[model samples]
Target: MAAETDRPAPEALISAFEPDRLLKQDQSGRRIAILGTIHGKQGILTAERAAFATESPEVLKAFHAAITQVTNLGDNDIYRWYLASSGGTNNVTAAAAAQQPPDLKLNLIWPCTESHIKKYSEQVVRMVTETPEIYHDHVRPYMSAKREEGRLNWVFNILEGRTEQEDVILRDEGHRGGAGVAGEYHYDDAFLMLPDLNWDRKTMGSLHLLALVQRRDIWSLRDLKKKHVPWLKYLRQRLLEGTVKMYPELEKDQLKLYVHYQPTYYHFHIHVVNVMLEAGATQATGKAFGLENIISQLETISGDEEAGMADVSLTYFLGEASELWTNVYGPLKRGEKPQAG
Candidate 1:
C-alpha cells in the first residue's frame, strides 16, 4: 500500500471549488446554480486548478473531467505531476524569483528553437486534419459543425466562471458566468478579467488572469497571420486599459499578454498575466505563445494570399501517453522523458 505521506488527501488538492455546488449561467440571465459540496472518491481530479492557477474554471472543470476518466488517468506518477501545486507557492520570497529564468526568456513553444517549432506544428496540423483519430479529439469539432446554424461558436457563450460568487477578485466587460451572464454579448468592448481564485484568495500561486477576446472568429493562433492583426492591436489596447482598471497593483511593464496555441479551448483569447509570478511553469511550454512576438510579427507581415497563417509557425506537445504518440507514432516510443514543450 502507498504510504499516507506519499499522497495528500484529495480534500487538500482543491481549495475554494466544490463541483456540486458549482453554478452555471445561460442566456436570459438564469443560472444552473447548485449549492452544496460533494466529496468522497471523485474529488481527486481537482488537482489541475491548483496546478495551473490561471486556467479559467471552464477549462479546469473540463480537465478534471477528462483526467479522471479511467483510461486517461493511467499513470499515478503523472497524476502527481498535475497535482504539483495544491499547497500554493506564496511562501517563495522575491529573492527566489530572481534565481529562476523569467518566463519571457524561455522559448514559449517547442523550447528548442532550431526546426522544432515548425516541424512540430506541421506534424500536428497534418495529424489533426489528415488523421484526427490520433488528435485526442481536443483539436475541436468546428470543422465538422454547422457554422450556419451557430453551432460550435466559441465566443457566443463560453467563458463560465469556476469559483463561487464571493470568491471572485475581479470581473469586467468580458467576464461571464460567475453570477451574471447573458446569452448575448453585453460588452461594447472586447476585454475580460477573472482572477482564477482558489479557496484561499491570498494563495501565492493564484493567477490574476485576464483575457482579450477578439470581435472576429480567430480561433487559436493557428488561424492567425498578417491579415488578422487588427485583433492583436485591440488585445494590446485592452491589456493596457484593463490592467489599470483591475490590477492597480501592477504596471503595464510588469504584466504580459500571452496566447496558448493549443489552448484548452478554441477562442482568440489573450492571457494577461503578472510578470513576477512563475505562471509559465504551470503550462508545459511550447503551448504558451508570446503575444509580444505575435504583435511584432503582425506589424511586419505583408498582406498576400501566400503570406497567410503559414507565417505563424507553431508546435504542441504530444506526449507518449497521448493517443497521437501511442497509436499514430507507436514505433517512436522508447520511454524517453516527456519534453513537455
Candidate 2:
C-alpha cells in the first residue's frame, strides 16, 4: 500500500465503499480481524475468506463490505472489513440518552493526546514547587540527615552496618531511610485530582520528581488553558461537524472521543468511539457526545498530576476502551488534517 498521504481521505473511501451495503457477519465470540493486503491479491483474499469461514460460519454471513484501495492501510492495499456482532458489546451511549447501559463498552487502541501531556507535565512541575510542604514536611525529613551533614565517615559506617535494625529502618523508610516513604513522595490529594498526568502502568508507582524538575519544558497552567484547551475544543467541534456532514445516515450522538494524557512522554492523542446506527435514527437531531467527559477528564488529570511534589509517581486510570472513542470524529474534517498524521 502507498503511504497515508497518498491515499484519499478515510471519509471519502468509507463513503465510496457504502459500508452499510456490505453483509453483516456474526462470529460467535471469535476475534474479528481486518487484514489489508495488496490490491487484487487473490491469494490473500482467498486465505482471509477461508480463515473467516473456518473461524465462524455466522461471521461470513455478517461479513460487511470490503474496500480495496492503493492507500489507507498501505500501497496497493486490499482492505477487508470483517464485521461481527458477537465479539463484544458496543458499550456506547449517546450523550443525549437519559439512561446509559450499565456495561457500555468501546475499544480505542491509540496514542495519548498532546494537550493532555503538556498540561500534565506542567502540573507535575507545579506540584513539585508550589506544594513543597507536602514533600518537605511529609517526605523530606525521612532522607538521611547525615548525608546532608557531608559526614562521609558516618555515612560509610551506616552503610557498613549490615545489622537487622538498619535493614528494617531502611525498608520502612525507603532507600533514604524515612519510614513509610517511597522513592518519590507526593500529596495524595494533589496526585488524585489530576487525571491527565497519569499514564498507564508504565508511570504509576514510581518516583521521578527530581527528573521532572530538571526538565525545562514543563507546561504551566496558564499556558495549558490558553493553548491546549482551546485546541481540544476546536478539535471537538471539527469532529462533530465532519461526522454529521459525511455520514448523514448515522446518528449524531454515536461519535465519541475518549481522551487520555501521557506526561512523561510529552504527547497527547485521541481515540474515537464509533457507533453504528439503525436507519430510523438517521433523521434525528445531532447531539454532541463525550466532549464534556473528555474536557472534564483532561482537567482532572492535569490538575492532579501537577499539584504535588517533583519525582512523584503519578497514578490515574488507564481509561476503558469505550471511553476512548467517545468523541473522535473531529479529526475527519475535509481540509483540517494535521500535517503530521
Pairs in clash, predicted candidate 1? 16-199, 90-204, 108-286, 109-286, 110-286
Q: What lDDT tens digits, residue by residue, belong to model 2 across residues 217-332? A: 32221113322333345445544554445445544476555332221122122333344312111112222213455455455543443332132332232212211111111222
Candidate-wise lDDT, in order: 0.44, 0.28
lDDT string, candidate 1, 16-129, tens digits:
335654343221111234444434444322111113433588876754443311211011111111111122224666566334322110112312333234343434322222
Misplaced by over 4 Å in model 2 are: 1-72, 75-228, 262-266, 276-291, 297-341
On lDDT, the leading prediction is 1
